[model samples]
Target: MAREVDPKKTRKALRRLKRARKKIEDSEKSDTLSDWEDEFLGSVEDRLETFGSAFNDPEKGHLDEALSGLQTAKLREIERKAAGKARKPMSRGKGFKSSFKRKGSGPRVRDINEDIEEETPEADEIPEAAAEPSRPSGPPKLRVVKGDKGDT
Candidate 1:
């Protein structure tokens, strides 16, 4: 039995491919397209035309999708580049200085020796009775409280 294919997905894929190609072509007149980008567009167009989908591997993309998520992202990136938009920079994440932050500007942890070297005068000022927690005088008092007897 032949596998069922959505005519909509096929048509949409073709439309997207043509638009991307047209964008690239138009951009090429004013800007240069890298060899890899040109080759990528051509290969994807060919694959879609011949196989009805650019990739067949389920691991690469959904069986019904013409372009994988990564493929679509790359396509958008190319489009952005062609349009003269700058690509967003990657994040360095925490525990490191950010692009805007000046060197040694962030809060720094002091050395253990520095804490030990500086003795606090407050330690001697506190009274001995207040310094330690109060001891319990005796065993806690017991109360024979009666609950509502209605449930029983």
Candidate 2:
């Protein structure tokens, strides 16, 4: 016969499992510091600790303010770095292959504009169904409709 677990032990195990799952969910939602940020924060902590030991009780409040200011500056620098990266141009051609020498029957890889032209039908090759498809003759117009109290 298989050994049976005690009810108390089973309940405790369930509670621990629930707590572990909650902890994992919370960690996933939280933003973790990068290696550089962690190093900076560690240095800040050391600075704070040094200040704690070097200064007397009278200057503790000033130390706290200094720590807060350093933390704010660190956060702002990280934000500025992210914003600068976002503003950088995306036309660097990263991951784009410049030459093609394949062993198969496929056209060599082309750039964005060339790929579009290759995929679309030529102006003369379009069939009647596509050559004169039904479409509005001119640009679409937007009109205001009257609502309650003649308000648009």
Best by TM-score: 1
Which candidate wins on lDDT? 1
Each model's TM-score, in the order given? 0.56, 0.23
Candidate 2 collision pairs: none
lDDT of 1 by residue, 1-152 (tens): 33244668767877876776677677746545678887887888787777777776678777677777777777777777767678888766776445557667657778788657666459789879778787889899899988878764
lDDT of 2 by residue, 17-126 (tens): 33433443455434444677656645544544444222233334333233343454454454444333333444676354656456789786767875564467777888
TM-score of 1: 0.56
**Candidate 2 regions off by >4 Å?**
1-26, 29-31, 53-64, 68-70, 75-152
Lowest lDDT sum, 10 consecutive residues, model 1, at 1-10
Tell me the deviation in Å of residue 45 in model 1.
0.7
- Residue 17 shift from truth in candidate 2, angstroms: 29
At residue 65, give the lDDT of candidate 2.
36
